[model samples]
Target: MTTSATRQQITGARSIVVKIGSSALTELTTGLDVRRLDALADAIEARMRAGSDVIVVSSGAIGAGIAPLGLKARPKDLATKQAAASVGQLALAHAWNTSFARYDRTVGQVLLTAHDVSLRAHHANAQRTLDRLRSLGAVAIVNENDTVATNEIRFGDNDRLAALVAHLAGADALVLLSDVDGLYDGDPRKGDATLIPEVGGPEDLDGVIAGSGGALGTGGMASKLSAARLAADAGLPVLLAAAADASAALTDASVGTAFAPRPQRLSARKFWVRHAAEATGRLILDDGAIRAVAGARHSLLAAGIVATKGRFYNGDVVDLADQKGQTRARGVVGYDAGEVAQMIGKSTGDLPADFRRPVVHADDLVAL
Candidate 1:
């Protein structure tokens, strides 16, 4: 079947975010492989021509840099890894541009760090940039800003980044291309392992064990599964498939382990708070707070919180955890850490008027 027709038949997802894994786009000892790049580009172009707005979150800058820098393997140190990404990003971008030129389509490069999606301002900037690119008929090629992003602020792996990007781009669907063909009940290398063709929800992933990534990739089956679930939870259908089956998976959602999405899509603020925003600190809430905040869907109050951990300011993302340090929900704080410390454990009726407002408003919070 034609790629466009197949995709439309699968779902009415007019916009899609396709993540190409590092191992799928490059050779072990060489940089980005031209054949792999062209093949994937061809698939993406077909969808775009079919009138679907397509965005690609590609992870190959480090892999592509390895060959050009004469490195025998992936770099281990942060500095060396950054250097490799610096070189590889240029090559990767150029290759993407050249490959898409085959279909007479233009490519726009968008490099993002965790802060870009976490901070309200930067996140909006990214949204506008990609939206503008789409309006101009340009396919956005997004990646984490590996060159300058530090471990402290980076989006650990491209899989998570892709999921966050999928939501940020307002994509209707998310397709993650990995080294493996599909998610399995166990290690695929084992004789008894069976491919899980469909995932209805989180319960299906209980006790599932998947292997880690190869030498050239950062994501593994576990990460892919997490990303798929994250996207699916936000009402975005997700497909996890082998990179070799890029065209098939991109077109035929049934070709991979398809994740069914929630019928009701989350609002933009809820999606960002639950997935993209990074927690700057932790809020230790009592048992009553946990139930009230997460269960009753009540706004988190200072009286419910027992203590605060870490330094954070007003409007920053903070985890609302229990005494055992288990996070139950996430929300945007209304006061700084210093201010919150003063009001911890104080009842609204007992506190002054200025300090009685919800510590974290209900609208700004999301249950995990």
Candidate 2:
């Protein structure tokens, strides 16, 4: 289906990614909930049997490890958290394997770090692996590589990771399962809350205040909304619903809130530059450059650069700032800081042969 497909079109999606939150899969006092796992497996298997490829992004490693490690609550320290993930990952994988085996279907486990999705080569490798697994008739179950990921490399929450995975796998739609049914105009806990049936873009969440999920989960409504936005920006439609409604959400159009995908599909490199990559330095630009890049969608030339701030190498992402220091865009620079310094105020034609082109090509740039 195309990016503009309606929620009714979800049932015909060729490929789908489902993300389940920790709160939906595990209990606070108990660990992994077997009934819930079985239900989710059934839902996924049904979709797969209907001729659509399904990928599951699940969270519950730390929650499952809590009881086995004799911890009274979720660990606060990073070391304990890593230890819990180490102990729980096996259990998590086994539960999924056992559940899927009831249908004689095999499941493959995939663990990823932030770098895996942000770096070009690593991203392509991950996409190839997932594509291969799907072709082999095995449903790929993905989770963050929490055991080895440092704080700097973590995706913060699996919501964002799931969004990136949806993009990488070229999923036609994304389903996020949580405790609540969908986004609300106000806190559902408080009286008189209403479910938001659809969100066209960020402006739909203008005055909405989103709080945290329960103790067992890391993401709240805000995280899920952000994830939905990311996936939608990449031209993937999204549906948010309660975990118990997985079967219906996959087959029915009106079960949950749906977010419409953007009309234009962003290239993989542009998506990464816009959402995942870390900027290395800043390039100060003049008013003419800002208007050209943001308004006219033009490439950034050396003539428009007033100054360069911080060190960066060729092919590294850098912030494109206006004279007032506000970052207007981000792009992959063609030259390092030193090379840029030599041609700062010169036109492309006036520069040496080595520097006779745009500093940051339009294709590599994303307007902020």
lDDT of 1 by residue, 96-154 (tens): 99999988889999999998898999999999999999999998999999999998999
Give lDDT: candidate 2, residue 140. Answer: 95
- lDDT score, candidate 2, position 230: 90
Q: Over all chains combined, what TM-score does candidate 2 have?
A: 0.96
RMSD of 1: 2.5
Q: Could you tally the backbone clashes for each prediction?
A: 0, 0
Span of ten consecutive residues with least summed lDDT in model 1: 1-10
Clash count for candidate 2 is 0
Please list the residue runs of candidate 1 whose C-alpha ends up more than 4 Å from where it truly belongs after superposition.
1-10
Q: Which ten residues in a row have the lowest lDDT in candidate 2?
A: 1-10
lDDT of each: 0.88, 0.88
